[model samples]
Target: MTPTAVDASIQRVARFGATERRLHTIHASAFVVMFLTGLVLYVPTLAQVFSNRPVVKGIHLVAAAAWLTALALVAVLGDRRALRRTRREIERFDADDLRWLRRRTPSPQGRLNAGQKVHAILQAALALLFTVSGTLLWLSERNTDLRLPGTIALHDWSMILAGVLVAGHVWIALSPDKLPALRGILRGTVPAGWAASHHPKWQAPPAGSAQRAPRAGPVRLVAAAVVVASGLLVTAAFTGLAFT
Candidate 1:
């Protein structure tokens, strides 16, 4: 129960629900796939080595679509209250968050720090730019003289910024002090002591709720499927508009 006891056997607290874990999994996996495929498409040496531009491009596009779909899926099917709360948490920044960002203080922090919020914002913005730019780039192949200057520039710059964020995120997650959080994301819980120290501001689920225990069960699968399908339908409509 001691804060210094970082072992797995220590008492656990519910840091993430199954929905959050699913969303995180999909986002991380999709991003990795897109990043790798994008690199292959962008690097001349890698392109030559692969000698299959179409395949690489195809994979990247698929990963991007999947990423978007997964987010929408979670939004529609996940716990609305929890999702809304998380959104507010990410958007809310106060003096405490500022101090945390400046490394001035560690206590009185919420589940997410200022840097994490900034990371989320930058990630969402970059993803939007990448998708829009990528769509145009893809369409150009089929439409002669449709090539638009600066499209590639936007996409490339987005990739560069994403790479930077991903690098920093990795470094932070691997640090000794942050390993508990990393495990929390992977397992959907962290030591109660760790939570008490790092995220003292974190709100535990209400009393009499079974959330304190390790509960990794997912949301309803059928419901999640419906949500994912709806998301795809919406994406299709937008894609239709883009093509027009």
Candidate 2:
């Protein structure tokens, strides 16, 4: 079903602003191009159809790299605060999220539903997969004189999987009834009517409409720091392995 009409007056937070929204749009567009190009480049039969196989491969590689970098910056770093807020706002398989999914409750202006939570988590996971695997592939190719042990097969399959997941991600993102979600990304605010109709729970009293901001608890902060350090350590280990 198409998205229910949202009012045009909800005050969206300046969460992603204009530049960030533009980045999001670029990332989304590049993802589609990269996936299609990668598919054509991977299959020998398809590659042979085009006389300029090298050119196509180059385009695919550049597009994927650009999309991956942009996603890491925009969705991961730039939206960390927004993600935390979204998680808090939609914690668990709450009655709210379920209601929205079932069409029992209308969508909230700023509140993301269960489907959105799933999409967000999956997109983050896919980004990590692409980055790590792409790095390994690059290092392996750059210094073939120094052996990087691991199956070329593994790298190829990982790339294929990432491409497939990205395509699926795009399909889900573009599904009908996601206009508010799209608009939220574009304008950074849902209309006031949308806010009331969709997420009455988040609506603050007129006297004190300032809702509490989502703050990363100490535990979450520590956990994220650990993950970052671990990623660095892993990359360093791989580089060391390549040299040795």
Candidate 3:
């Protein structure tokens, strides 16, 4: 191959940008805070060892709030083009992805593979569930009419599920083969060879070439509408429940 062709083939690719890196950092820090505080609050041994229930609970609540706020800010201020690209990558599961999942073929993925996409969606849903349930549990502290036991049950169960998922996520992220992906999130780029091997479908732009900013498409508009509608519906239902 010619020098130009080789240069094109081995060019470094942008994986995560500044905004994505910041968001991931915020989420990771919040998760660590919440998880540690939660363990202290939930575990009998840790509770005794900590011997400061209120402080632990306070820290957990603050972490939860921070996590939620970070997510809200990202939704409001993050680049829509980047978000759309990520969503499309995560949502698309072709035959290659399936074959890779089944171990029937080598990894033929784009920016995100099936496992990462599934994990991202599941974690997002779990975070939402945890937030709702935690809020209900908090409200139950002041309102006797609110079903405390049910809220507690929901919150506890959600936390347990989230904890398990987080453990798996950590295991995968820290694994030897996946460490480069973690580094990409931290540094906003990965080696061209690594990208080429693991994500064969990802086409890296030529070295030092600028990537064009994508415009908002119909799919993005529809997705935003759906999210807004869902948020409204959920808020209305919660308000009704609170009043009645």
Which candidate's lDDT is highest?
1
Model 1: per-residue Cα lDDT over 162-181, one tens digit each: 99999999999999999999
Reference-based lDDT, residue 101, model 2: 72
Leading candidate by TM-score: 1
**Total backbone clashes of model 1?**
0
For model 2, the stretches where C-alpha displacement exceeds 4 angstroms are 1-23, 68-110, 144-176, 191-244
Q: Write down the lDDT of every candidate, Cα atoms only.
A: 0.75, 0.56, 0.71
Deviation from native of the Cα of residue 203 in model 1, angstroms: 2.9
Ten contiguous residues with the weakest lDDT in model 1: 206-215
Model 3 C-alpha lDDT versus the unseen true structure? 0.71
RMSD of 2: 8.4
Candidate 3: Cα lDDT at 160: 86
Compute each candidate's TM-score over C-alphas.
0.79, 0.56, 0.77
